[model samples]
Target chain A: MNYRGPGRVRAEEKPMPEILHPEDCIVKVLRSCICGSDLHLYNGNVPDTRVGSTFGHEFVGEVVELGSEVNKLKLGDKVLVPFNIACGKCSFCRQGLYGNCHESNPEATAVGGIFGYSHTAGGYDGGQAEYVRVPYANFGPTVIPEGMDLDDAVMLTDVVPTGYQAAEMGGIQPGDTVVIFGAGPIGIMAAKCSWLFGAGRVIVIDHNEFRLEFVKNYAKCESYNFKSIEDPVQFIKQTTDWLGADVCIDAVGAEAAGSAMQTITGRKTLMQAGSATALFWAINAVKKGGIVSIVGVYGPTGNLVPIGNVLNKGITIRANQASVKRLLPKLIDHVQKGTIKPKALITHRMPLRNVSDAYRIFSDKLDNCIKPILIPPTVKE
Target chain B: MEKIAKGIPDIKDWGIDADPENDPTYPMKPNRTDEEQNGYTWERSVQQAETVEILKSTERPNLSAVFGTSVPPKGLSGAIRRYAYKNSEGQFSHWLPLLIADRVNVVEGIIDDLKKGKVPNIYAEKGFNAMWKYNRKAAIGMIAANVAAVSALGLFLFRGRIFNEGKSVKKALQNYNM
Candidate 1:
């Protein structure tokens, strides 16, 4: 699928990619997912999202060809390529910070390369089609172990690692009450992961009734519909002995819909990059000296955040892109052990040609869609 | 070394990583599997004698220990990339033009492929074969949706000419009076 602009994508035929670098390899995609972050590009929130660019960041494929310097993997190796394209030799990669690799997306500071994202993320075409060219193959693609489900493997590429990192950043302690500010796939997974770190209770907050219901059952946690409540922060404080919850997570990012002021200023007017409604709630809902972990995607531009309250509360904030390469070993073990079922989150699976309709269904939240996977044409059955 | 630990017990976790094979990063970072641990085993690789034009990073003081035989900077996109390398990779001027150059390089590759008498199979490679074999339901739905869209567009565009007694939409509505 090719992006024409915001709210517009079409299926088109283009030349197949070749190895342009010594560390590159061509992959025949088996499964690809439309990530929540991809919606940022679909809505034209990301800058330099060129008209002809493809958008997908979660994929697992079979390596069909290799570059001259690629000896770690050979032909016919099934692998899950991490979204971040780190060059392994960079200072950040040396420190296991693959998301901050200096050589990949040196387009600017901070963010590293991401496949199927805008030029801000190294401008590499995504694996929404039959094939994709993976750079830094030695550092990015991990061979999928035998007997693993393809659906679960694709989730490991982005969703599993990202949600795991969000919970890990919270530093959840035993008997700590955690409140998550979204019920999306990542938030739902984060809720499930918090239990592994010894959280006493987890409550997911969302305006959508279906998502709240889904998270309650899937993550086996408490759920709250923000629309029915008067104020979310007040509710959290009331439930947690009037001191606010121990940890709060923001998974909604800049497109949060709880505040009219944030919607207008951050989203509608484009005055700021995106709405900080989720950030506002998270900062005000946590206990004093508590932690707030954020894994949501936001624009580079600043938004109206309540920094004063954050300073006064002495809150420690941790946010960054997920480093899948660093967390793959542990996550794979969890999956094989039947502890974390990533494939259970998938609600829809459609062919690659139905991408436009699939995007509409997911973007509109139609038919209680939780996650959508796109099957490339190259795969047989 | 034991004099300092004369009064203390050795723990299992303290020196567990003494074995070089216990390193965690080498598994994921395949490019660094042969790297010198702690800079104690450092050694330069044998240089390639191939005289291919190489485009090394400006940040590097000299050529690398080994380089690949990639095509040199020659085409229009290649020229732009060479100029882009003059600036730091972190500069936007360096990356924006490089992105545009990638698209240009695609067109150049297509032209080169055509010159070699190779043509891409649009119908097969574009997934029509899969539609016939595995996704007939989706293919039919797509066809029906496209037909409905075209029919609706045709009726709206030729509304003035198709109607006999009432040509315009307003006149047609008048004919079917309430």
Candidate 2:
């Protein structure tokens, strides 16, 4: 999959990836998925969405070659490569802040290396191809445990960990009312994981009826279409007895499509930092002193946020790229125990050659597509 | 006015000297008689000279002592790895220069605050050290390995491809020992 600028991706054969460092390995990709975040790039929302780069972060594959310094896995090891690249020896990585790895993205002090996101992230090519180079192999690229489905393992690369982190950052206490903004894959997954954190009432808010309905059935959480509600924040506050929800999550980032003003400034005019509408709603709807966990992908530029409310309320806002390497062990255990069905999020699967069509379907939310997976040609059925 | 250190501020400037009394060469008493002034002046000068010498030393800091062994990388390897994977547009074209400017501002801010003799946060100190240290040998090693891997991979990828003969191509391949 070659990115040919905004709204353009071509599925063409490219040079096979090879080990680039003593700690790198070459993986023959089995499966990769199109993330909602990738749509930010497809729609030209993300900065530095370079042409000729492949785009897929959630991937699972078989290691065909190993670097000399890689000591963890043997040849042909089936592995799930985390989206973020991290060196195990970095201060951030040692502290389980793998997503902010100091050794990965020296171009910027903010975001660390991400697979096929953009230059804003470390510009590593993604796994929407026959092969991909896995850096710091021992740190990421966890081997799939026996009997674990490939589809399940693939989601572990990004979605599961991101969703889990969103819920974890919310600091949900028992019987707490947790509301998640957006019914996207991450949003739905966050709602599901909220239950694990002892959320008494889980609510997913979105504008799409299909997604709201999907989350209701899939995550066993109450769902609301914000368009139908009079005012989402007021509604949430009323539902929570006027105190507001204990936790609120913003899973929809820059390309949020709603509110005529935000749509014009963020999506149409390219002013301010992507429509932070969902984030604003999360901030406004959460109870004073409640946690606002954000996993949304915003632009590097500043976003218009209600800082006065944040300051007065003493809300704890925790946001980061999911440190998948840190959470992989526990998430795998959850998957194995059937506590989380990571693959239930998959709504469509197509050959990687149909990536252009797949992107259109998912980006436009056509045919009620919730999540889409790309099967590499090299993978055996 | 504080005596600013006379050196080019690198990416990680940490501190600055503030007191004239801390300088050996600055006169303490100008009107005293030779004999009375000599003894006191000599003593003060010696103490200040030692202090100034300690402050002027330019030894590279040991990151392990401060950050407990998980020291972040301190040189171009971090940047080079990113460059290798990225396309030409994503290279050091725009963002890298901005990052450098940001680092300079942070270091300058640190130096300005150091006049109060207040220790910067441990995280700040660790970050300063990581940015300051020049691990040239490690950087070269990493770059060489990456280049070799890329060249080998390229060769393997297009093994049977036909190419038009050119003197420039021959010279480049010869230079690379291919």
Candidate 3:
């Protein structure tokens, strides 16, 4: 699926990518996912998104062709490719901050190269195709363990790791109350993962009725529609004995819909790159000196935020693209033990050809779409 | 900050999670003994033997630890790209010809494919089918522009004959009917 500006995606056949570097390998895409971050490009909130670019980052594929230097992976090995395209030799990657690799995306300083995230992210085409040329193949791609469902394997690429990182960054102390903003997949997963970090209670905030209900059952956490509540920040404080939650997470970024001001002036880019309604809420909703961990995708530029409140409240802000390469082994163990049901999160599984319709359904939130997994045409049913 | 809270606060909820036995996440805490979290042992991949000619940037002191073996510099477009690597990447001289060379390489690839008896599907692969199906207005406009260009070229190529035929007809009319 190629991005045709905002709110439009088209499936088109193209030339097969060749080995661009010795570290690169051509992976036949078995499964790719439509990530929440993809919606930023779909809505044209992300800058430097070219018209012809493909927009998928979470994928698992079979290594059909290998470059000469890739020694860890062999031809025909199935691997779960992380969204972060990090070269392991980089200083950041050496320090386990693989998301901020220096060598992979030499042009940027913050987050490193990402697949199909547009030119700002090293201009690499995404895995939402028949085949994708994966650079730095030796570092990030982990061979999928035996009997692991492809759906579960693909979620491990981005959503699970991001959700895990959000909770991990919060520094959640034992018996601390955690409030997560947004009931999207990442938000819901974050709520679930918080329990692993000893969260006393978890609360998810969102305006979508279906998503709220889904998270209630799925994450087994309290869920509320922000529209129905008087105010989300006030509600969080009220529920937490007027002290606010210990840790607040902003899982909703850029396109948060609660505030009209944020939508028009921020997410619409009238005044900022994207909306910070959720970030604003998270900041104001947390207890003094509480952590605000953000894993939601945002533009590389600035946003209208209440920095004064952060100073006064003494909040600790932790945000970054998740370092998937750093957290995969433990997550795999969790999946193997059935401690986390990653596959249960997938609500829609559609072929890559129907990506246009799938994008519409997901964008419009039609048919209770939680997360859609896109299967390439070559995969057997 | 109240002098760092004077060691411990006297608040009602103070000193929570201070004991390991009472900590809810005690079982969930990081186990340093776990082999996975411990200092992991990894090996650097053996350097790939460079059997093909590789291009290195002028800015770098040496070639990368690894370079691509596929599509080594060979044809005319490759020569242009090879020249591009001789200059600094910041220069337009290095990048502009690269953009031109990419399109030039496509034509070279098509010719090579023809030599191998592989008919390349330029139309379908170029997204014409997608454009016509999704955005018909742009497709129709592109078709019209192509047609006009071809007609103009045909007229220009046979302009002498067309003008000569018109002049002969006028001269014949002057002699016959007057």
Model 1 interface RMSD over true interface Cα atoms = 12.2
| lDDT values for all models | 0.74, 0.70, 0.75
lDDT of 1 by residue, A323-358 (tens): 889889989998898778999999999989878767
Ranking by lDDT: 3, 1, 2
* lDDT value, residue A316 of candidate 1: 86
Per-residue CA lDDT of model 2 for B31-143, tens digit only, reads 22344333212111001111110101011121110000111112342343233324332334333333343234334434534875854442221222222233345436645
Enumerate the candidates' DockQ scores in order: 0.05, 0.01, 0.04
C-alpha RMSD between model 3 and the true structure? 10.6
Candidate 1 chain B: worst-modelled 10 consecutive residues by lDDT: B10-19
Give candidate 1 misplaced runs (Cα > 4 Å): B1-178
Candidate with more favorable, higher lDDT: 2 or 3:
3
- Better candidate number, 1 or 2, judged by DockQ: 1
The collision pairs in model 1 are none
The TM-scores, one per candidate, come to 0.72, 0.69, 0.72
Across B43-157, the per-residue lDDT of candidate 3 in tens digits comes to 3334444566655556545433333233455577678767765666556565555544544655675677589796755444334544565567766986898799999999999
